[model samples]
Target: MNIDDMESLDEETRKEIEELRRITPEKHGNAFFAQAQFNLGATFIKNGNIEEALEAFSNIQHLHSPKLYAAAQYHIGEIIESNGDIESALSIWRNINHSDNPEIYAAAQSYIGFVLFEKNDIEEALLVWGNITHADAPEQYVQAQFNIGICLSEKLNKEEALLAWSNITRLDDPELYAQAQYNIGSNLLERKHVEGALLSWHNIEKKDNSEAYAKAQLRIGNTLTEQGDYQGGLLAWCNVERLDDLEAYAKAQFKIASFLISFEYKQAAIKELQLIELMDDAEAYAKAQFNIGILLGKNSDIKGAVKAFRNIKYEYDSSAYGNAQYRIARILISNNDLTDYTSAKTCFELAREVFSYEARSYIRILELLEVPETKSFGLSLLDLLNIVLDIVDILTLNFSKYADEEKPFERKLAHYTSTYTSNLLLGNDKNNTRPSSFRLNTINNVNDPSEGQLLIRKLKDVKDNSFVPLAFDKKFHAFISCFTFNHDSLNQFRLYGKQDNKEASGMSLVFKKDFFQSKNLIGGISYLSIDNTLKITEAISNINVKESHDIQGQKIKNENDDQELVRRSVMRCVYLDPTSDYFHLAQRNRLTFFREFGDNIVIKNGTKQSQAEYEWGVYQEYIKIITEKFEVAYQILKTTYKEVETEINNVRFTLGSLKQKELAILVDEILLPLKYLIKHSAFREEQECRMIYITSIDRPEVTMEYGSFLYVEYEPSVKDHLDKIYIAPAALQHKRYFDNILKNVDVPVEVSGNVFR
Candidate 1:
């Protein structure tokens, strides 16, 4: 039978081998015996019996086919390499001298250069590829030239790189040629030849069907964006969406979303980011979720931010996964109103999987891990992680490259109230009306009728006035206390005494600004900043967040202070200006609060990290063996006139990333209560920063006032908090009375008698 017919039947090849053995050497001769042995080896290889295959290949005598004898050695090298013994593999390839099989000789050289290049021995790799020519192994020769181009580029020989890359033809290797075009375009772009770069990148898609085509489009979009042609850039990016390359598609989408954000279309940007969710790429999805979380956090939508971060899968990208973990932990710790140490500890532990902290962090963790089991012998450093993991944090790891210590500066805030209220505040022996401490009133009951009920009014208009009953019908109002961050503004004295035209000249109660931050109430202060006072909310806005991400821990001890942190989510600085773009978003958020987020909280399964690809397990060894069998078979047949092909479809495997989605569930639940922070733009002039505490209506902390309005007694850290008292400018006559009232106070007393006027 013909070898072509025999090639398809391994069983026939085995039968032929047995028949050849039965016949004498003189009957069929060395030709038929050698052919049968070679066919048996290929059969053994296909069956994944490497030992038997190697034995059969060894039976091929050099007297019959020297190329086949040489090809067998090449097969052994592949086996060695697949087993991770690259040294032996390289040695075997180096000795494969076969002038009879020029294709195999050049193909082996191609692999040798590839291994060298991957190991970063660029010069030697280039030297090996330089020996290849178009006459020998035509396809391998083109691939060799591709590697030479990379080598030349790495050595800064831009001119030589272009010349080497120019040698690749679209017909010979379109993928490599497309890559060359990308490199050439990049080089031209760097040289300021904008037209040349565009022309070069434009031809990539004409001949390329691989990821290189999408990459070229991505580059084109970047170039257009850089040249100030935003519409052209956006159009180019939009074209990359359906290019069958998820990573490049993700890059383009991110740019488009960034453009939307820069143009003050944040909601549109959010919708664009959400588009990444429909793609099948895990890394791209993780990246999109991370950015959305950050944007949400910046917008003071803490719930949405947490949900976005939790959506990242650990299996996608280690850095992104680590960042997601660290960010979640930071959010939990910063949101200390709930005092969720247990949850924070779990998040910190997950973050530890990807982040490697400095010596100081390990030392800090070690210091805290002082249990007897953890305090063992000299091998403590190795076992330290095992112990420290039980109690996570002090991992003040920010969004930056490394965790850093915080820097703090002290300051004070002045709260002006009626002299009678101040007298009652200081717990002086007043009438029966004096509370145990200062009172934070419910929003509806606040004196400012126009500004105080702004949030409730806005909510009543959204979803066709739907959320009002769900939020307010149950009397679930947020209690509030307003504070202005002015150090010593003259207008404060003028503004406070005449609230609603009430002639109530009050003394300013100066308290240490750290009092609120210490309690982690997050009062209009960025959760990112745990230490800084309210001096530069406007200035800090200009400073790069990475540079100013220093926070010192000053946790409030319950027994050490009478004040307690109630149910608070976030404290955003009052956004000023009615015409500002952010004000529009804030306004929209209030109106659509009920519509975007339904009456009940939602926990999405989609928010958890995506699963990871599984290891090539059962067929790991077989995959290597069978793949090498084909390599050897190709080499032995390269010099022959006949051609044969073999193929085996690969199976895919996966393992999913796992973590708690409590953070995602909390996002919808928290947004409703935190909605009270935004107010009507009319209150822009007051520049008031209010703290919103969403407590249940039945809590005993609610104190009834005037037999109708409700107030909560919040004993803020007031003992050392009173910095100084300034009697209102109009109340100069009562300055002596204020002094007598604050006689026990060690702070300075001043008269604000028409100082500005």
Candidate 2:
């Protein structure tokens, strides 16, 4: 009876046969004979000697020993089935005596159910499996229960199915038990009993059935997620990694990778997705490739991103291919390399079919930023910047010359500067001097940090999905000059800066408003309160922008009311040549699709580019920089027109579906003058009127004052437009010298002496 230590079935069976032989048939009345036959048959089956096993089992008879006889009969059926006689095996199993040997009888019934189910006899199989119980045979009983659950689940009897599956225990049959638990959880989830479903899945015994165990973990993760317990779901999914089931493991890893992104664990998330690429599931593998490519691009791993994108099969996922191609082109251009532009162009051509409008936008941008060695393709906005600044300074505030009789046509403005710099404006030099020109400083060097950009930061309502970064890559250029006119007294002059010495004496150059108005310059400053809260509705993308928090009790001006804001500025002055039906955006205003750190354009990392994380400032950079720009270039370059007008000779344009507010946000973000014009409320008392000159500063005639700052000198006729120049209190000491300097002039040069000093 202690045969547990036996090394082989042959040895154990031989010892049993010898002992049974010793109990002669005369003493045991043929019962020992039946027992010896059963042991021989079992040893034959173990050795895979089917014919010998059949012969041995057939010798056992129910009259001699009923239990041994029924067991031998069951062994014969197994041999018949293994030998391919399914009908014979089922016939033999069906005739087993249940009363004499319940274990063998249960096994026979279990086989019958399997054969019927395999033959599509669902009703017959369910009936057979439903009759089995633990009282008959524990192992066979659990197998029957598991099958019954599956059959009932398919038959729409969910409650019955759950009951059948729940009755099975790991102690009876671990593999079957695990599968049964998985089915119970799945059925419960289908019935919308989420908590019960998750509980069952979580309780799955992983014994040797890793497939079912892995599946259970996946279900638990999903169930928790559906209940809004994302952390719980992620943790559950993470548990699947312990198993060897490739499909389940890949699915869990994908979910975990995506979750890690929200927490900014980029490298860890990328590592997870990378593992999924080698896993068994085709769908998860493809998605992992795409997301990995995206994450790599964001992390600035260009080579790795490109390789990941290229690994995706176009036949597997064409949509992902197109999107990936579009990004590949962008990453190539983001490096600002001309050699990469060719490859980028090829990628765009491939992507154009899918991203018709967006791909075309970037293609046009490449043309504008084409290598200078080739035919020039830059936004020659130095002239345009100068022209738009004049247009805005001279004509903008007039609102098309408001025709209101009550409004004064004649206005006066003032320009405050140091006495030493003042002399340069009155000098005789042509381009270098200003009776001929006035100086324009770069917008960045201005006192207000918000110069050239004020609208985007304060905007609240934006459809981030529509965002496109302006494709124009060359350094966006804006030059600005500040002035205060409404209050041009000594106090105003002093507010500009302190008088360093005699040369730095702050002089307020009072001029007739008619002179500037005649010269196409305006006289008004729009001071905005940046201190007021900006209603942030859209997520700022990759473009660098300062971050601010939301708190109560702060005045919210642009609180979802986005329509009133204006987007047009000198930065994007569209020369709508209606005749050609083609025009370019104001390239000189130094505007961008979205900008950060003053120079880093974030178009490559826009939402449209499929960047999932939100740690950027450019809320919307969706620059269809179209007919106002690159669309014109797209039509010119494609030359793929049929009878329509997209031929190389003709011009075609693209205008994206931009809502007024969204478009305003996109354009306002890059408009260079708004950054200068919209000063903070803190400086409201200065009554400032800024003159912004947006242009190419790459080769500017910029003068550095006393080794302090750089400024571009422009020649404006200040003498002709002169009203009267006011002498500051410090300059009053040199009144006679000032009078002698302007003795030939008819205009007054008065002094405002501060008696308090």
Choose the strongest candidate by TM-score. Answer: 2
- Candidate 1, residues 1-757, lDDT tens digits: the string is 2334444447766576566446433576766666666666676678576666677767766676667656766676777788899988999788777474567778778878878876888788888888788888778887787777666765667788778878888888777777777777876775568888888778887447556667667778888865677798888778775455676777677778877976778888888878875364666677678779878988989889989988887787544665676677667645645335456556666655333231213333333234342222212332323222211111111111111111111134456677666656665434434434666676665444343333333322322212222234234456776664443445666667433344435566666553454322112212211111221111100100000000011111223224223222213233323233233111111212232224544323445321110111212332344334433432332212111101000000111112113212221222233245455555554445554454556656567667677777654535335777777665667777656645644666776534642
TM-score, candidate 2, is 0.45
Candidate 1 minimal-lDDT segment of 10 residues: 542-551
Candidate 1, residue 469: how far the Cα is off, in Å:
66
Give the lDDT of residue 393 in candidate 1: 17
**lDDT, each prediction:** 0.53, 0.55
Per-residue CA lDDT of model 2 for 1-757, tens digit only, reads 2334344456666676457446545677778878777776777667665676788789877888888888888888888888889999989888787887888888888888988887889899888877677998898888788778777776778789889889988788777777777677766765557778778777775664777777777777766764667788888888886345777888788778876875689999989888875446655676678778878878877788889878776675454566668778867765654248778888877766444434544565466457442112122211222232333342232212222222222245567777666565555333343343566665555554434333233222121222233232124445555555332354555655236643325677776643432221111111111112121111111111111111111112332234322111111222222123333332111121121123332235243332221112222132232222344333322222111111111221222324223433322322333344444444554555555444343443445567645566543356655677777766666556555555544557776533324
When summed lDDT is taken over every stretch of 10 residues in candidate 2, the lowest stretch is 539-548
